[model samples]
Target: MLKERVINETVPIQKIYDEEIMKAHFSSETLPSVPLVYKIQPGSNQARKNLTPTLPSSSSFDIPDAYQSTNSDETFLIYDKLVSCKKRVLIFASPK
Candidate 1:
């Protein structure tokens, strides 16, 4: 298993998704499109930040795990499940 850490500055969700979609639109294997909606929230001014590992040259293997986001601004650690086989995932969405 491998690990990656990322911290993205705060930004609107739509902006982030748009940027990603535009970049992936030209890709050969891209996921289907999804509807877009924007709802301002308390932290709408904050940017989205995530940490993912840098894929190596060898594409034969998968990341082999999942992740969880933190509610507060803190460093979140991720571990491989190959050893424990536990699915520990978390997602921190903005308040509605």
Candidate 2:
């Protein structure tokens, strides 16, 4: 049986001020200046000639027989049972 690991585990909650830190770092005085003028260059014919369009050799969607499960109802029933059991345990542990 798979144990309820979440009940046993302790998750460390972190207080992050990422947005505030980013805003301070990217303030006007520290920000990079953009160039007023720009230059453009034409693509070389040799670079274009070296490139080729590619298509998948075999475009197929196939599912193996082993992967297809016939016990979906049983799977869902087990999941439902586990969820209910966990809820009961939590309610029992909590003080009203």
Best by TM-score: 1
Residue 71's lDDT in candidate 1: 44
lDDT of 1 by residue, 1-96 (tens): 001111243344555656655665654444543444344322333322224456556433444223333446343444323333343343334333
Pairs that clash in candidate 2: none
Give stretches of model 1 more than 4 Å off: 1-7, 26-96
lDDT of 2 at 38: 19
Lowest lDDT block of 10, candidate 1 = 1-10
Model 1, position 93: C-alpha lDDT score? 46
Best candidate, lDDT: 1
TM-score of each: 0.24, 0.15
lDDT of 2 by residue, 24-85 (tens): 56657654452111111112222232342344343232333222323231221111122442
* Global lDDT scores for all candidate models: 0.39, 0.25
Q: After superposition, how far is residue 39 of candidate 2 from its true place, in Å?
A: 12
lDDT of 1 at 57: 61
